[model samples]
Target chain A: MSDAERLFESLARAIIDADETAAVQLSETILAKGFDSAKAIERGISVGMEKVGDFFEKSEYFIPDLLDCAAVAERATAILRKGLAKEPVSRGKIVMGTIFGDTHDIGKNIVALFMEAAGYKVLDLGKDVSARRFIDAAVQWKADVLAISTLMTTTRGNIQNVIEQLRLDGKRESFLILIGGRAVTREFAQTIGADGYAENAAETIRLLDKF
Target chain B: MTDISPKERLDRALLGKPTDRAPVVCPGGMMNAAIVDVMNKTGHTLPEAHHDADKMSDLAFDVYENTGFENFGIPFCMTVEAEALGSAVDFGSLECEPKIQKEIFPSVHDAVYLPIGAIEKTLRAGSVIQAIHMLSAKHLDVPVIGSLTGPISAAASLIDPMTFLKQLRREKETSHKVIDYVVNQLISYAKLMADNGAAVISIADPTATGEILGPKFFDEYAVCYLNKITDAIHEIGVPVIIHICGDVRMVKPQLQKLHGDVLSVDAFVELKQLKTELGEMRTMGNLSTYLLEFGKADEIFNQAKHLTTKGIDVLAPACGLSTSTPSENIAAFTTAVKEG
Candidate 1:
């Protein structure tokens, strides 16, 4: 194999193994060796995390390893992204956050990482975000999707509030709404009028790909 | 009229005994100073100088005095085992309770080994052993139950749960090795607790149940490890109670066959369906924690009565009550068990 191909392959493995330091160092090494920055991110970091996500869905990888790999991918992506900033990017934009009154963010954070790695411009609003804030951001960013998450059964109603306000404000059709988290089921998503539901981070990517 | 001591009432319920009514079982939810004050008013005292130990016993006895519960559980928190394992924990005040810092284990391989002599020396371990000792000395009249977290759950708290779950996926063999080692440690602890004076050993493994993993992963990892621990504890002749949080309907059949004397369900599970599915194994719990925390006394009573009608062998909280849950809410649950 060519040296660039080998470098990209090694970078991908390093990200999957959750070696953030190695992933970042490898990205620079690849760039120093004259590989394209965007190609390294797309072929190395993103592809590596996608494989990690698949392993996680298949029960071959657990949460800790997935989190570690995501961290590694994020570090490597940050380094590669600086080089790509000089050029205009064509990735779709997304607004993501956990709904109001819910402090849980582990699941939401994983979904956000997957969305970001999948080449979406993620606008993370963090936890305990209100409905109005979510809609306002979606409108401001012209996001393709507004993904809402809530881990508590008590606060899952907030997802519906966001959907209702968006519809009332006449922006419902402009962006697709996806709802997910531990307490949310596919049935609950349909009941709340969300466009889709993802059981886990890997499923979120599949849903976004279809979108 | 029939004769029934608190211990005898609990024993009868476990044996499917017919009694005056369904016996109330406190599955380690009776903690906090508020509960202890009521128990002290009803003639209970701290078994030892340790505040948590004294508080646990007093809370258990208080449930009996105020609500007429049939069973008294000591060492009301699950963190004792994790603390013993050397995990740093912050015991939140009466309002906050205790919690392990989320960032305790930043990496999957950061010395995730269980400490040597962890079963014998930790403060909470000593507390549990001593609590049992004191309960046997003073409260032989009532069944004194002890609680411990299953290996997987304790390990999750010590390390990061997300990391541990990922390790299970990436390195199944290594994960099993860790689980097996931890289970051995737990079995030793369980036997020691039983020998010290605990009549029933309640195993709380909320993280290893159905909510986190589907049946495929559970059967492969959780079921076997739990069976080994339960089997060892049962060999010493102590009854084992398996408690799993979340909706465990899919795992009820597996749970029934795991050699535990009773299976405790969280409120999310439908007790009627569980009863029909398991057929003869004793089942307890299904009172919503939120209802107990936020709802009125009447709601707690009605929910407890409703669970009893579904054929629950013992009445208890679906999971540990939040520290902020009012003492009145627990009283309402115990009252329903007494009247029903």
Candidate 2:
């Protein structure tokens, strides 16, 4: 294998192993060698994240494992982002947040990080975001999809509230609506007029492909 | 079934002893059942009762009296322990529960050890204690469960959760020190609750679950700290009900090591299956709060009946209740358990 291929393989393995130091070291090595950092990210770190997503789907890697890997991937991204920021290649655009009255954002944050890793440009409006803000961000960003997440059941109604607001503004058809969190279910998505549902961070990225 | 008091029924069921019927109650923190319509109808509400002992007890009573829950769970919001530990809080509006606006320490390693009794002396913590005292004194025949945010959860709240969790691996010693400090504070608070007449102590450790922490760390951290709190509560002659969020299957082996009086699992694990797996250790909950919130009244009742037949020792919402869950549905859930 080529030296560049070897470096990329090691970087991907470091991410899967949740080795932040190794990821950072490999990223610096790639950049120092004048290798394409964006290529390194997409071929190296992103490949590892695909494995993380698969582990999640298979229930082999849970939230804690994802968190560790996410932190590792983030360190590598910090090193690689200069090139990535300029090129700005993205598969899809999504605006995501937890609904109003819900400050718990771990799930939302995980999805956002993984979505970014998966080549999606995500505009993250953090926790306790209002329905108006969700609709407004989606429209402003010209997002292909809007993803809403909440751990609490009380703010769950706010998902429907956002949908209703979209309909009121005649923008309901403009963006695909995806909803998930601890409290959300497939039935809930149907009940609230959401276009699709996701159970976790991996599924969120998977469902976004349909949009 | 012979008529028995709510206290007798739950207490008996808790000890893995025979009971007239399985007690269906809602413990606070993550399992809070104080919905909006219940508050609207009764004129007893949270974000207000959350700070006053009288109002807190009044609402706790209202939930039991109106909703048919046998026990009273107090201090409706989850941010109390975090607030007591020096996190800035935004006590939410009438329709919302409080949330931690910011942590006291920016990182877990920065966790400074507070003087003992520090948590108990906080204003809202005092209010929670007094409310339990009032409720237990008034309704001597009903179970009064004083709920506390579990130790890891309290620790996570005081430091940024993501950072705190990373520290558990990266900075293991400091993380344990922080969790130990939180556990000490919880024991002090729990001791005060027992002294003040909290019949049972319920812990909702949503952050300290196998699904979130993974199995090995869950055994090392979640089970270790929860066992400390549970052992202390047991020393005070009070039964403990501990709720761990998400599927418990990952940590099922470690769960057997847990010493809490009752182990509460979320809806993903059927109590029947848990019964077959764990055998006779007394379990509570598995009712899907989503089902309670979105399902028809009959649907909830049927689910409750199914759980009843599964022989769940105590009936409760799988996780916290949504404020928007209709009173009629909750009423049906608790009512079905009682009637069936």
Could you say which candidate leads in DockQ?
Answer: 2
Cα lDDT tens digits, model 2, A80-190, are 876554865789899999998888887788899899888899999999899999999999999999999987776788889999999999999999999999878999999
Candidate 1 lDDT over residue span A21-56, tens digit each: 678888988767767888888889888989989987
Predictions in order: lDDT: 0.74, 0.87
Q: Tell me the spans in candidate 2 whose CA falls farther than 4 Å from its real position.
A: A82-85, A186-195, A207-211, B1-3
What is the DockQ (computed on Cα atoms) for candidate 2? 0.50
| Model 2, backbone clash pairs (residues 3+ apart or across chains), number | 0
Query: Which candidate achieves the best TM-score against the true structure?
Result: 2
- Give the 10-residue window scoring lowest on summed lDDT in candidate 2 chain B: B272-281
Sliding window of 10 residues with minimal summed lDDT for model 2 chain A? A80-89
DockQ of each candidate relative to the true complex: 0.22, 0.50
- TM-score to true structure, per model: 0.71, 0.93
Q: Give lDDT tens digits, candidate 1, residues B37-85.
A: 3534654543332235665555565655664455556565556666666
